[model samples]
Target: MSFAALGLVPPPTFCKKRGIEGFRSHLSLCGVVVGDLVSTSVPRPPGPVPSMTPASRRGLISWAELDFRAYVFGAIRNERNEFTDAFIKQLRLRPDKFVVVSRSETDAGQWLELFGGDQDETFYQMRSRMFEAPMASFNNRPVGHGAWDNIRMGRDVLYSTGQAGEMDITGYLRKLETERNEGWLFWLKKDRFKVKYLLILDAQPNRSGIQLIQDVAWAAMCAAGYVRGAYSIQKYVKATDALLQAKITERLSWLPPSYALTFPVSNHHNALLKARYARYQA
Candidate 1:
């Protein structure tokens, strides 16, 4: 039903404004559009809001503003030759743009200190800016459980940035491919609309030398091995087991599968294996 038909009028405070335009600007600041105000009786609930366009937000962090230490930490990993090469070139091109945060300085305080605070504030309210997500602290345990431990910690650290509208496309994509197929829906059912910025965390330490390098060279070798065609099932089982061990598939429903920020491309396989599988299907 129309709000006018329901016997409602603009609030007296709204009428107090100079004109409709002033009231509309105030409504927009409160997450409401002037047109929406007329069509709907209910008001939008108050909460955090997006303040920038996708392009403008993305522009804020050029390669130069990226943390250098984490880049080095990630670049040394297997299969990361491309990233390492790119980062090294950027570092040489503009060393002044780099932000250095050491291992001991990974805490919330260090981040605030390095990034600075607001005009009237003495500190960068890290907690105030933190984005809360469900999977942030999913599998908490001591750090001795190998790759799983690393993933758990990584998820937790990344969750803290959700308030900034960081979207994890890779995680969301994986959910569509794997988990949702098995009835694990409703992962990002609520916050999907609120997501504005992509979540691309700097490489963390738990994954430095663990992932195998599977570039074109490795794909060629695998293809040659698969041509022999013996024990193909056994090899497939082993690969599956390794993937399970890595605990590297997208577990977070909020993430999409496009970005490879924290983990290697989980769906990659050697060319030989692909050919053998296709032939077996035939």
Candidate 2:
């Protein structure tokens, strides 16, 4: 039913409850990080509010003023190539245009650097000056061919950017050419399932972005492997198999599947799953 149809009115305050759950997630997407000290425009509709865009109630404070340590910390594992090579590169070119650097020679083991920190006050003052918002971090590059291409990565190659070429396309096309020259994909029964999968968290519900920030940080921690073995509930439950069902439900229902952080939703979970996967293991 329409909110207005029922004569519902909004609160005096505005910009507090615009989006449903993706608010903090959007901040992460925008690359705002821990301790960056920025403000969020959480709009609270005056009356029966209508839909709004992200820019509607541009926050009085800019999140750029806050710290970004935790988000960078969460990126450690993905940067180390533990998650997926593609993911490592994709992060470099995120839309938020966050700046990252590799502290060591190992893969993408770099931390984030916000450009606004130096002039945080200015960033907040210029909130309305969207067009000229100076970046507050390093590597102020744009997305290009691969992963880090968009962001300002020192490297400028497709491989480093996480981009692909005709060969990649050709390989995908060739996968369709069956041995019989048929235009269908064919795989052994064993190949139908993945050997393993990684669950990563994105945005979350509730909070003034603090809770979401912490949750995202924790998820990133798992993604970065700082909280090693956290990706697998089985590993933790091996010591004691209590509250297994509840844990699984809470995790799945909490976030979107696309951003659903998982604990190795293994086929070995319960008796039914075990029975179905037992023969395959043997």
TM-scores for every predicted model: 0.15, 0.20
Candidate 2 yields a Cα-based lDDT of 0.27
Candidate 2 backbone overlaps, count = 45
| Model 1, C-alpha of 225: deviation from truth (Å) | 35
Write model 2 residue lDDT over 62-132, tens digit each, in one string.
Answer: 21211112111222222324444433344333423222332222324322222212222211111111111
Task: Evaluate model 2: give its TM-score.
Answer: 0.20
Which candidate comes out best when scored by TM-score?
2
Q: Once superposed on the true structure, which residue ranges of model 2 sit more than 4 Å away at CA?
A: 1-72, 75-84, 96-102, 105-282
Model 1, residue 24: C-alpha shift (Å): 34
Quick one: best lDDT, which candidate? 2
